[model samples]
Target: MTYTQTTPDHDAGTPGDVGDVVRLLEPDGSRLADAELDPWIADLSPHELRALHRDMVLTRRLDAEGVALQRQGQLALWAPCRGQEAVQIGTAHALAPGDFVFPSYREHGVLLARGARPEGFMLAWRGEEHSGYDHTTINAAPPQIIIGAQTLHATGWAMGAQRDGSDDVAVAYFGDGATSQGDVNEAMVFASTFRAPVVFVCSNNQWAISEPVTVQTKYPLAGRAPGFGIPSLRIDGNDVLACVAAMRWALDRARRGDGPAFLEAVTYRMGPHTTSDDPTRYRTDDEVERWARRDPIARFEAYLCAEGVLDDSALAEVAAAADALAAEVRAACIGATTRAPETVFDHVYAESHAPLAQQRAEYVEYLAGFAAEEAR
Candidate 1:
């Protein structure tokens, strides 16, 4: 699963013909001038820049805690977002309060940015609840477990918003693997045909579990959108500033009824796909080490420090906040109570149903038989 960077072919009509990836912040903390993107983030203040850095630090801390909890048997599983914090935090920060989000299972950073409580995030992983937060409250859907499904949900929601004549945009976050799914293509089709006000964000993390991106496609993922008549951008996912600018561009277009846009955030997965996965078997330590050098948090920290937006005290404050959040999440996950098994049937229907009631009764009786045998 070692990734080798290939030069994109600029041949017209070819998939690799998509323009260069949009990058505003270099890996070494230098700024790359982009006239089109500069205006998008030009109004950001020093405080806002510090906040972005803090968000990345907090996200990485949360991810670390999640991995530890799963390894310690506190959670069923955890999908690590170690190297993709910029993609999540930056895009989420660009969202308006009225905008809706549809996310894949690994979007904890997005949920956090959308104001979801840390405790609520642990509920689903602990098997104590079906969803972590109220979708209506945050204008985001529950994390979709099925690969590529959230894209369809986002498209449908966007269509609904268009019908209601609302300017709010719908954003869907998915992994590179999901782009290969039929649901994703179908979503693009419907979105393009109707000019749906949606943004499709593909976090191209270079691997789909054990498979490398090369196995999926030889061309850039962003190029696929053009075939559906959707404009797209390829962005450097490790640069938070670029992510924010790119997302703002896409969101603006969607809000203006310019139809759906696709974004391919080129990033790498520095950790295992999930706590249950073993990266050592499928990827090299060298590859992981190389990506670590481009660590999103570290890069952003460097940039902020250079700009005098953050000093030692500011860094320490952010670290302390992250530590506090991680502790809170850990305690909540460990202390969460397991629900009754019968409760699975509780939300199966909106209201009472005759057949469902009978089935529930039979299940109850079956459980009672075990108790009767134990008593005897």
Candidate 2:
């Protein structure tokens, strides 16, 4: 079956076309109507809308705490998800419990929505663990550090699900920079050819480290997927309602065995690429200020308030909840202790091998020398 484009031809693209983005809520907090996308989120009640706002608020607080911790030398590094809260929270909310997610290192909002503990979220960044949480427990893999590698992993898992005759879909979340990686292209090739049940979400935050996205591709990022035979949508990543609708639409297609779908969420990264880099060196304050006005949480909050779904009291409650969670995260991160150095050798082999046993013994002995020297 041929994949049908969900967006208009004018919006989908030509070589020079900058695709018209799909949006439900304007940057100014006004709502727009889309016949094709509206029904996907029509069932969302006022309570659910309020909940989305709360999730974004909490996610931002978590991001803030992460940045502060890294600055204070608690976390080794942190990828701030400052301006992309809507894409993460909205897509995450659309996901079913059984759907698996393979996320890049910046998707803290996704991890939080997946019910991952805040303490667990900090483990890897704290340099205390290889993986923050068990993939089997949450149906989501640990945040992948290698750019675009998770796309291949998600495609492989989607193929596995197809072979097992299961309708379960695998979703891969990556940044715009990952699209330039060969692994992402190869994964798309396999996914399209095999008609694997997968959704590829590209959060185009307009920057890949010190480089701007304009240098990454001349055409819209969404246009690249169609060449691989996957239908794609480009949406306003800052608009939570648009995100929810677009993700639900893609998820439905995958569940129906229609094959893989791609979504490009156009957003801006309002902070540095990571705690280790200085964004000011690459981007001008004027540009940053322009994007700041389009902040995802503020936009969503405005919409909620306009709709009478949220009031000053409700906003205060959300703020209190966010503050409490931020405090919990800070305390947990600060109090976390590193594991015994020797334990690193424990999981190398499931069953101990003779060589591994010998190595472990030598390592333990090596550590003992430090203890002896300290005693002296």
Candidate 3:
């Protein structure tokens, strides 16, 4: 992953690169180094690079800061997407205004890039009962914590979009482990048979709770997509340029009425799967250090420096800006508004099922009884 190392020569397939995992940027920080993707970079301007930097930096800061809040008990739980910012943000950027995105809980970067209010995510983790803002406002569905359920939801959304006379697309993000789930397979079948306008983005970050990605799929995850009749692609998930381009292509295909596509982003989960899990038992520090060498931030910064799009002073300023953002999130977390004590009863049911109603009443009465004792 060192900058001096020559770009890895991949033939679009490696130990399991089933979907033609294209590489536009080198793990060591070279861009357009993938001759196949050179045109995309040549077309990108310096300002675009700056915007990319901002998105990636802010996302990473939020992820790290959110994890800290979890450790401090400000949040009940947080799934850190610490090292996967480039793929998340890049893909989000590729989405159009009418597109819908269904995300797994770890996609904070995608939501942020799609203009999701930070409060929506924060309040959820703070133990709030609902999304702070309506998801449709950002062309996104509410975050789903269940492993692979969002795939079906996304497919259904795409079907609706198709019936409504619009060509807008839907992108569903899931992990390597999700590919094996029946819901995900059924989603693929639905999308393929109906030619739904959807893109299934699988971020194969090499771990499912504690299982390696290899265990999820015998072949490269991307290859599984084509088997379902969806043209699939695999790309260096850490390479910002490649991720953006891959997503762009997928979106274009969907909008053009070409049907759904699947993308397997080959990256790594650099931190614990969640605040509760420990990676040390399953992975070695040396392995982590090796991946760190291919840090997306470091890789892009080096590319920017090489391309004269950013200098040390500029990077220092960005880092400083990121630090301030982190501080702000930390401060905001300390004062995160609590859910109203009565909220637990408010949305328990639509028409009010008798069983649930009884339970809610009992719980409220119990709380009231405790309060009366305190008053006495």
Who wins the TM-score comparison? 1
Provide the RMSD of all predictions against the true structure, rounded to 1 decimal.
3.9, 2.9, 5.1
Off by over 4 Å in 2: 1-19, 348-350, 365-376
Models 1 onward score TM values of 0.94, 0.93, 0.89
Which residue pairs in candidate 2 collide?
none
The predicted structure with the larger TM-score, 2 or 3, is 2
With a 3 Å backbone cut-off (N, CA, C), the pairs that clash in candidate 1 are none
Clash list (residue pairs), candidate 3:
21-234
- Candidate 3 on 1-376: residue-level lDDT in tens? 1011122223334423423567776766875565545554566678878878888998998898888889988898999897788889878877789999999989999988888755677887887756655776888887888888999999999999999999889899998888879999999999999999999999888889888765655556666666677887678788889888888878887888889988888888899999999999998999788778878878887888888999878888888988987876776667676765767766555677888778877888888998899999
By TM-score, the candidates rank as 1, 2, 3
Relative to the true structure, candidate 3 reaches a TM of 0.89
Residues 194-216, model 2: lDDT tens digits: 99999999999998998878887
Q: Model 1: per-residue lDDT, tens digit, 1-376? A: 0111233333422222213567888788988899878899998899888878888889889989999998999999999999999999999999999999999999989999998887778988888888868888998898999999999999999999999999999999999999899999999999999999999999999889998887788777876788888888788898999899989989998988899998888888888988889989998888888889888888888888898899999988998999999989998998888887778788767797999889889989999999999999
Give the TM-score (vs. native) of candidate 2: 0.93
